[model samples]
Target: MTSAAERPLLFLDVDGPLIPFGTSSGHRHAAASDSSASLDQGNPLLERLDPGIGPRLMALGCHLVWASTWMDDANEAVAPRIGLPRLPVVEWPDLCADAGPRGLHWKTRHLVEWASRRPFIWVDDEISAMDRIWVAAQHPAPSLLHHVDPTKGLLDDDFSALAGWLRAVAPSRVTSTGD
Candidate 1:
């Protein structure tokens, strides 16, 4: 097994990615200050994941970093409420922009700046139609930064799809189903 230093980074986001909401497995409901978004909840995919996920992700050299708006509020109460391992968070400070209703812009701008020169996958339901296209156009491997859409919280198809993607993109993070 590889050490933590060897892992590629999985930039994790909260809200739409982790929490199950909405109607489709890839669809979710994300509430913002003034507006809400529909996105994928990858949480169900990672929750109680088989050890293979962590090890495989680590084997492929993956480091999990929290990049959600909940960063500041993560460990305080939300972390436990959300069912994560303690309160792992990102080192990079946020640019701190209010996503409000147009959170897609916030994610894109922040990702562009935060990811800087590193590779990252942003899991959020708020990703706008444009951001997906924009990221694809800019990144070396557009797939490096993935977007898991849990239209509805923890749907079977979404879970299956994410498992495949994780194994495909970061073979190390791949594990058998917890579902």
Candidate 2:
């Protein structure tokens, strides 16, 4: 069996995948009660995080890492609300230095570096074909640049897709025999 460190990584995004945006989704909230929301933090949309998401993500069996612009704040403000422990945060390098091909999302290059050739799944709202093409050339291992709709955060379908891909890629290690 591969060590947990050798398992694929899941690079999570905050604004889109975790906290849905846009007024049309019906998830947009002005504020949440202090209990549900992150302690004393002021991002009203923090309430949009589905508390059930943490367990769902944990079930995927990949090493979860925060790749959002929220940086370490995701560990402090988001993790607790979703019932996740502190996860590794991808420290972004200079924005100008890591820019990839034009039209690539700003995070594309940095995430590829952070994965360091291990298979990885990048869950974010801004994934583009350009980013996929670049990673294909730059990253030697398997990768999925899964784009989540910002208007609606991760739904059941999203979880299904993530699990399917993870299982397919690392069946022996990632497959959980039970729900």
Give the per-residue lDDT of model 1 (tens digit) for 56-80: 3233334456777656444443344
- Which candidate ranks first by lDDT, i.e. highest? 2
Question: Candidate 2: where is the Cα deviation over 4 Å?
Answer: 1-5, 24-41, 175-179
Q: What TM-scores do the predictions have?
A: 0.56, 0.85
Model 2 scores a C-alpha lDDT of: 0.81
RMSD in Å for all candidates: 7.9, 4.3
TM-score of 1: 0.56
Per-residue lDDT tens digits for candidate 2, residues 64-164, read 99998777878888999898999999998887684767899988888888898899999998899999999999999888889999888898888888878
Output the lDDT of residue 27, model 2: 52
- lDDT for 106 (candidate 1): 59
Number of backbone clashes in candidate 2? 0
